[model samples]
Target: MKSLTSIIPAPPGWYARWRFGTHRTVTYPITTWALARDTGSEHTIVVGVDTNGMWPGGDDERPGGEFLRYIYEPIEAGTPDDVFNPVKSPADLASVG
Candidate 1:
């Protein structure tokens, strides 16, 4: 088992990975909205096991089993705001043209 703790918050688009004994590893990336909400806070983190290039061992090596230990920290409670505006429809574009 492994544990990670951080006092500084991760920034949007930031990513990190951990490798265990050159065989397994995990990675995480920060969310965009969290960065916007708290420029100084590090809230989001993820943990996963890396099975890259490993051969499947039939029933013992199911896809679900590969990522069973992966964990992603959730964002704080809040209504998620849309980050992008709605695009114009084909009709709207034709009218503009």
Candidate 2:
């Protein structure tokens, strides 16, 4: 998997066959979220995936798989946070590994 900071744009529907162990098709941009781990904080990055394998668009040459940066509020330890919970960007979060 590409690092969150290194995720550049790519063609649409490109992630359809990107491989997620199973034959999973990323049809919607809301299909998944990246959970970046850290010691004090964690990040849930919202992303978009191919709805169809066909890359139909006016800008075929432009990078695809582009996503909006997800902004959220900070969470204290022992607090519950869902996918929609607010948190800092992955770039600001330092990883344990």
Candidate 3:
């Protein structure tokens, strides 16, 4: 049997997708989890996958087409409480379309 992590690297949760033009689409499990800090700001790291689903030839032929995508968004600055708290589980992640 395959490990759960291998099947679903992230816990099931509300996800978000960002599209860049007609060629790229990025989808990730959304959360308020912060991974680092920069001076007065708390930065949240989110890992996602990019897919060129509409590409005529498909993504397999594109160089490093299946590469992982990492994003960092600033959550807050200066105050500890202002920093967004981590979403502990998929159930806790906010619902979205």
Candidate 4:
């Protein structure tokens, strides 16, 4: 079985996409539990997750068990760019509109 660290890859283009989407700049918390704080730039937003070891399954078994909490965060637009950077600036919005 793959370790959680090995299974979860670092987010690709997270900084650039997040910066562009929210229009400001954003920073991730040093630890995973902290709520992401928005930098309040024109179009920036912060995103985060909690790693509280809430998974189910016995200590001797793999994590894929009945009691596991399957938390699914929806990525809208069904595309990586759309899901990551769904919004553009006001000027760009005008053109798209």
Q: Please state the error at residue 67 of candidate 1 in Å.
A: 20
Q: Pick the candidate with the highest lDDT.
A: 3
Candidate 2 shows a clash count of 6
Ten contiguous residues with the weakest lDDT in model 4: 25-34
Which 10 consecutive positions of candidate 2 have the poorest summed lDDT? 12-21
lDDT of 1 by residue, 1-97 (tens): 2123332344443333333333444343423212111234554343321223111122233333232232343444322221111364656433421
What does the lDDT read for residue 29 in candidate 4?
Answer: 17
In candidate 3, position 68 carries an lDDT of 32
Off by over 4 Å in 2: 1-28, 36-66, 69-97
Better of 1 and 2 by lDDT: 1
Q: Name the lDDT value of residue 15 in candidate 1.
A: 31
Better of 2 and 3 by TM-score: 3
Model 3 agreement with the true structure over 1-97: per-residue lDDT tens digits = 1111111233334333444344544444443322322334454333332222222122332443343333444434222221223544545432221
Cα error of candidate 1 at position 37, Å: 26
Could you list the CA RMSD of all candidates, in the order they appear? Answer: 17.4, 17.9, 15.4, 17.5
Residue pairs with backbone atoms closer than 3 Å in model 3 (clashes)? none
How should the candidates be ordered by lDDT, best one leading? 3, 1, 2, 4
